[model samples]
Target: MKKISIIFILFLCISISFEAKSQSFVGLRGGINIPSVNYTNFVRGPIVTGFRNEFFIAPSFGVSYRNMQSEKIGVQIDLNYSTKGWGQLTLLETNTFITRINYLELPFYLHWQLIGKKKLKFFVDAGVYVAWALSAEQEIANDVDLVENQIIYSVEKDNRGDFGIYAGAGVSYDFSIFILQLDGNFKSGFANILPVNPFIKENPPISTNQVPSVQLSVLFPISKD
Candidate 1:
């Protein structure tokens, strides 16, 4: 009986030590999104209609939670308010037009720690995300010098949802009580997002959406098992 009791206590101690080494984490994340469009052209559109795009900086903010199942592998989940769009602007002219679409997205990432030390870890993350469109909007400025009569257009019907794949690489620094991650991520959309200018159901003005960004996220431990 004494030998059996000792063995059980030793096992419990080993389990507790293992649990203490890996703690689950929660954090806040934010990034800048640069959106671009790829045309699925069946009929060639006008040259002027083709957007001369410049990176329109958009904001993405979210909450991230991580579950560490082992020393080198884990899962990350995030819920975010993300924006996508492009702008048509001529450098020589003041007239400008911009389109923006917003989404509420949930992304699930499979995280692999490739290399690590006590203070830092390098990781690769891959995942898929599903998003619902919150709204689509357009802003137009015919002439910048004149007393501005700006037009804001509300898109009534757009592709309502999107599903996509994401992949990224990052490094995380441990502060003991908190962690900071810096990652560069690319996301590719798998479906059409459009009302396609003339509301053409058969063909869209633009074929699909593209979103790519670099993110900085900070995390805290909610509880340790």
Candidate 2:
């Protein structure tokens, strides 16, 4: 099954590239990643209470290839490394709990250029992504001193293969050579990161990871005609 999928993807890419002519680009994207969860109830320690989920921004970077099928339509594909996790900060700000998970992700987006002028262009994209977990770690700190007053543990059992949806909108600037694009996007996981019945006792009952990001990308024309 995996071999067939790989072959199909390669064939699709070759077919698209064969027709792109001078209407293709290679790009790099770098940005902030805010990982979140969908569930409201999660417990930890001796205190069985809801997790106070907080913003835990991380770095995201990717390389992309895109071929414009028309003035207003294109397909963008990316291979990237991204960070996803959630953190908790209490009212006192003394104690903290954080989970850090990293993944190598591949995403495909259907790109639409809405207002393509000379200097600036507007666009929107929607797509899906597949991600494989690289690492998962959990940390708990009792004091903000950062003097290693914490408990660190690895996730015992995890749903490593993640499937998700992504959507975003932004504008790009044309430098007459390479285009620089800035955008805000969201990636939401449909599957839980934890097993339906986690093996570990401390693990969250249910968690759906969601990432919101602000991205900056630069695209270099493949073969300008």
Candidate 3:
């Protein structure tokens, strides 16, 4: 599955290059991610109590490609490396446990132009994404003092593959030769990242990932619109 995704991305890149002289835009994007985990059917063990969920700041960057189907409608695809995870704060916010996971994500969007036909435009997009986890780590820290601090690397039980939905709205400006766009988006995973343990199948835990992000991109026209 991972191989197939990689191949598809490559194919898109090639197609974009070949279609450079058309009504298409390709660009680079960078953003900040606020990632968290939602837990359902959680077993409230002793350690789970008194821990509050928190968000962590992470980085996301990628290549974005768009093909304008019409003046008001288009299609977009992005290949990005996104850092995502959630943090748990102990009672009184004295200590914190932050789990970090990094993934390669591909998202396809239906793009819409809500306003403006000239320099500045308002737009919206909705899509779905597939991601493969590349790595995972955990950081433990003491908020009150500097006594306990450690980092652990583990992926033994993590379910790496994730699929999710994404939606965003933003504004863009045309520079004659290139376009600048700013987008704010939210993504929510449908797949459970916490795999069910066979031994504990009767009472398994469930967790899903979500991220909210703001991105800026500079798109150069392959061919003039």
Per-prediction RMSD in angstroms? 11.4, 5.2, 5.8
lDDT of 1 by residue, 202-224 (tens): 44455566888889999998876
User: How many clashing residue pairs, candidate 2?
Assistant: 0
Name the best candidate (by TM-score).
Answer: 3
lDDT of each: 0.71, 0.76, 0.76
Clashing pairs in 3: none
Ranking by lDDT, best first?
Answer: 3, 2, 1
- Cα lDDT for residue 159, model 3? 80
Write down the lDDT that model 1 would get.
0.71
Question: Which is the leading candidate under lDDT?
Answer: 3
lDDT of 3 by residue, 4-109 (tens): 4456556545544553333778999999999987754334432333336767799999999888766677778999999987887654667788888999999886
lDDT of 1 at 205: 54
Model 3 whole-model lDDT (C-alpha atoms): 0.76
Query: 1-225, model 2: which lDDT tens digit per residue?
Result: 345445545655664665543488999999999887765554455665455666777888999998887677788888989988778766456678787888899887778889978778999987777898898776666654552223232445657887777789999998978999999989888777866554554556666778989999999988644
What TM-score fits each model? 0.75, 0.78, 0.80
Candidate 3 least-lDDT 10 residues: 144-153
The superposed Cα distance between candidate 1 and the true structure at residue 110, in angstroms, equals: 0.5
